[model samples]
Target: MSFLQRYKAGIGLGLYAVGIVIGLLFAILVVWADFEAYDFQAGLSVEQKTKGFSCPLAITSNESGLMTAEISNNSTRDANATVRMMHTLGSALVVNQVEQRLTFSPGQTHKLSWPIQASDAAWDRFIMARIYVVGSMPPRSTADYCGILLINSPFFTGQQILVFTLALALVFVVVGWRMWFVSNKQPAIDAEKSSRLMIAFAALVALNIFLSINSEWLASGPLLIVNLLLAVAVLANRLNKSTFS
Candidate 1:
């Protein structure tokens, strides 16, 4: 086959692979954005009044599921606020640690974000988030605040999940068809041609590896899968050439 014909046939497969990866990422981001934040009022009860800390506002998560707190200092002086996000599962404690720290001046409202990653598996079990705050008071005293923080599940609607599954299935179907069924048999390639094809395949493998490092889905399963498909394609092509040469 001429170079032009080879390009024409390969372009569709390449596009499908790239499309599936990009589409999957876009869908996750969209779903996360839709259900990212939860507002929890803190220090409102009479119990909090005795402690001298105030202004419990909101807690939110970013697209990556990092937690953040929107709080205002109601005290008369600057205070150091330490916020913690604790994960609990059905009367069992799973995770509890400090999430963010911020210094707030009197009446200052600030949004402090922490790198708290909530795994997808957290949804399968009962999960609850509690935000705790410890603030510095005058005369070396410390005040404490605690409240429940609610974060909605990203996959609750399930639309994005369905879309991703369909797109992934389509990608597999197209790539499988080209690799196992579609014939690319030709006369035996010279050493130079074989080397070039090997180099191209190596480049594809490297690209997939790089992408997988940045994507959990690809790193976990899809990268190895597609590489296996590519290997089978190459082996089948070579076997056909050797047989018919």
Candidate 2:
């Protein structure tokens, strides 16, 4: 009989260990991507206030590189607002200007938007959009606002992608060798113990699926702990003595 046929339980445990390690890697990637997205948001939001508009300002960017700003008017009269975009690195502006004009009624919330051809390299700099309220609208009613937007890029850089892929390949190769070759030396576990290990493995599989789908709710540290525990369980089962009695 083949070694796999003689040691089915050991084979299952080895397979489960490989799956657990892979799952851990995926969890790490998810957490890293989440932090990267947060950094982009923090870098792109402009907080400087212009003179003449007192209302709060919020800014967002779309996939097509369009930036939108929602400005609230606190004044009793309507006013025209001129919005302009600037890319700044350090103290100097780096790119061409884009501007738009919009009118906001008293106590009205106005959404101003404009499209731009922002390059991925632009993300390394600060891109800000300023709104200047024209006419007699004093800074007390509607303060001028500067909002920022950033260009989107891939979650992983070229070097990070290359390194991560190599690490994953190495893990797979090591785990594959252990599962197919080393497992042949392990004793055959009884059906009851095998069933119990399989049940635990299945539960972890389900948990991993849930975590992948709803990763935002839980921190990655906890996810990593769970994966480590799963690895321990599978490795323990792989080394357990086989006794039919």
Candidate 3:
């Protein structure tokens, strides 16, 4: 037997293994970079009693919502504070903002709220609500943020979408590997089908990476599942061809 026939199975298996490993590693790298870019109150002492904020963590696209902040003067004297609330798309553009100055007597607490809404264009993007308080002694300065999801699906939440995608990908990978190894005559890889699948997979990967980096995991999860399903269909078709031939 020539070299081509002698090690075809090995070559096929190697390709699949290498592709999966590289894809997973690339995904991890993208997630790591995004995490590093997130701001989690580094180098600041945050006191919840002095200044704190609350808002819904997730909302549908084009939905109206409210963001509230509570400021308290825990000290023995009166305090002057400036509180600012901002709504932004991703991290770059501010969509709405309000600023107010308030005076609080000792042991007094005041609550402030702002009306907020997410546009349809903000779907699959984060509606970031940030609260900044200045001129509060002991607290000095404080910041709080709420990341709202502009959800695309009403039936499923972001976490559910993510889990389903992962499970589907794993099933496809396992089934494809078994199909390749179980048959005595390994299926001949079709160049045209393989190329098309690769192109589709690459496109999805790029789009998913972009969405993930922007904290749009809910949007990317569906694409991830679709890519894996396409992969499974292509592999099954190729194997069936070999079986009939």
Question: Which prediction has the highest lDDT against the true structure?
Answer: 3
lDDT by residue (1-245, candidate 2, tens digit) is: 46555575356445645655565555554443333333331233333444332211111222234445666666899876655544333222344455566677898776656554334223442343334333334443222322232323445333344346446644653454445443444345644454555455545544653454333414544755776776676566545734322
- Whole-structure CA lDDT of model 2: 0.45
- Cα error, residue 194 of model 3, in Å, equals 37
- What TM-score does candidate 3 reach? 0.44
Error of 2 at 55 (Å): 29
Better of 1 and 2 by TM-score: 2
Task: Write the number of the candidate with greater TM-score, choosing between 2 and 3.
Answer: 3
Worst 10 residues of 3 by lDDT: 33-42
Model 3, span 99-169: residue lDDT tens: 89989888888888876555612334555555778766557777766565555665555445445544555
For candidate 2, the per-residue lDDT at 94 reads 48
Model 3 residue runs over 4 Å out of place are 1-51, 89-91, 120-124, 153-245
Which is superior by TM-score, 1 or 3?
Answer: 3
